[model samples]
Target: MDKLLKILSENSAYTTAQLALMLNEPEDYIKAQIKEYEDSGVIRGYQAMVNWDSVPDAGVMAIIELKVTPQKEKGFDEIAEKVMMFDEVSSVYLMAGGYDLALVVKGDTIQDVSAFVAKKLSALEGIVSTATHFMLKRYKEGSVALVDVEEPTDGREMIV
Candidate 1:
């Protein structure tokens, strides 16, 4: 991966001047490179990874594993597109084992999520089965730690 992309992935807030300084390149070069990346769709978009747990009533998140019968010609693409159209769905991924698709969904409560699965997702054609797991805690997200770092433990153990 390019150093420029790596730096942008870590912190997209960095300006072109800052990026050029870090990469030891001219500002014009940095700007042109970024422009090319964006034009070619290599750099999709930028967004802040918010700590939703810190916000009151931020809502519940669940991972839904779906088993579906792939279409003859379209395979999973058809069903994947249909699933992603729902507002509750945040992400959808095709899996290699156990399930066909893994989806990240958000709702106000477990009941809300369950209702969405029972009424909306399950109702879709070709769906064989669905399993939903509600998120209890987030220790890390997008390689960013959410919890406080603790001091290193000593090798010695208490005799008690």
Candidate 2:
């Protein structure tokens, strides 16, 4: 009913009253719409994007490449499930080409990640090979976070 999504995307902490006032809509309407969006899985709730750069342990990050055979009966889901349960594994992706999976793992030291792979991951069965590429810097990440842009030429519109 209002620009609720736009408002929420920019500032997730905005209260229903604040959003309603900004969008010039009633709070009840905003609430109902948000509820519907949530139910439909359109709005997957709010989150605070942590500035990992400021974190004390931010320097520690690794990209672990994995080769896993898709199980006969269970398939990628089964293997992916085990990979995700590890505390060090931050992100997991079912990949194409040479590697079957790509894992973004983080820990205080390389040994932490290695132990996870050697003890936890490799031991899990179906895992073929693994190669780790630690990340030094992240140029961009996650949906290209919509910060203030002076030139709004609709890049999405133009590119597509």
Candidate 3:
């Protein structure tokens, strides 16, 4: 991986000047490289790792493991593309374990996610089976910690 990309992945909020300073390159060069990466599709959109648990109206998230029959010529690519087209799907990854694909889906409620699996995902062709696991809490996402800080409390008791 390129050094610029690595830095950006860790913190995309860095200015071109900051990135250039870190990489020991000129700001213009850094800007050009970033532009080239974006134009060539090397750099996708930037995102923040949000701690949704703190939000009151946060939607439910689930990890759906899928077992699918690979197509004759297209293999998993065709099915994966079709699955990615769904609006509720945040991510879809091809796995090498018991399941063929893993999907990260989000909905307003557990029932909403259930309906998506039963109606949309299962109804698709070549889909053999699925196992959905709801995310109860997130301790870490990417390089960020979602856990709340706790004040230190001494275990000693004071005697009068």
Q: Which candidate achieves the best TM-score against the true structure? A: 3
Model 1 lDDT tens row, 1-160: 8999999998899999999999999999999999999999999998898888888998999999999999999999999999999999999999999999999999998899999999999999999999989999877888887766674678789877
| Candidate 2 lDDT by residue in tens digits, 67-121 | 8889988889899998899888888998888888899998887787777778888
TM-score of every candidate relative to the true structure: 0.89, 0.73, 0.91
RMSD of 2: 6.2
Worst 10 residues of 2 by lDDT: 140-149
- For model 3, the local distance difference test gives 0.94
lDDT of 3 by residue, 1-160 (tens): 8999999888899988889899999999999999999999999889978899999989999999999999999999999999999999999999997889999999999999999999999999999999999999988888787897563577679876
Q: lDDT of each model, Cα atoms only?
A: 0.94, 0.80, 0.94
lDDT of 1 at 79: 99
**Model 2 misplaced stretches (Cα beyond 4 Å):** 1-10, 21-25, 39-45, 143-160
Q: Candidate 1's C-alpha lDDT?
A: 0.94
lDDT leaderboard ranking = 1, 3, 2
Candidate 3, backbone clash total: 0
- Write the number of the candidate with greater TM-score, choosing between 1 and 3: 3
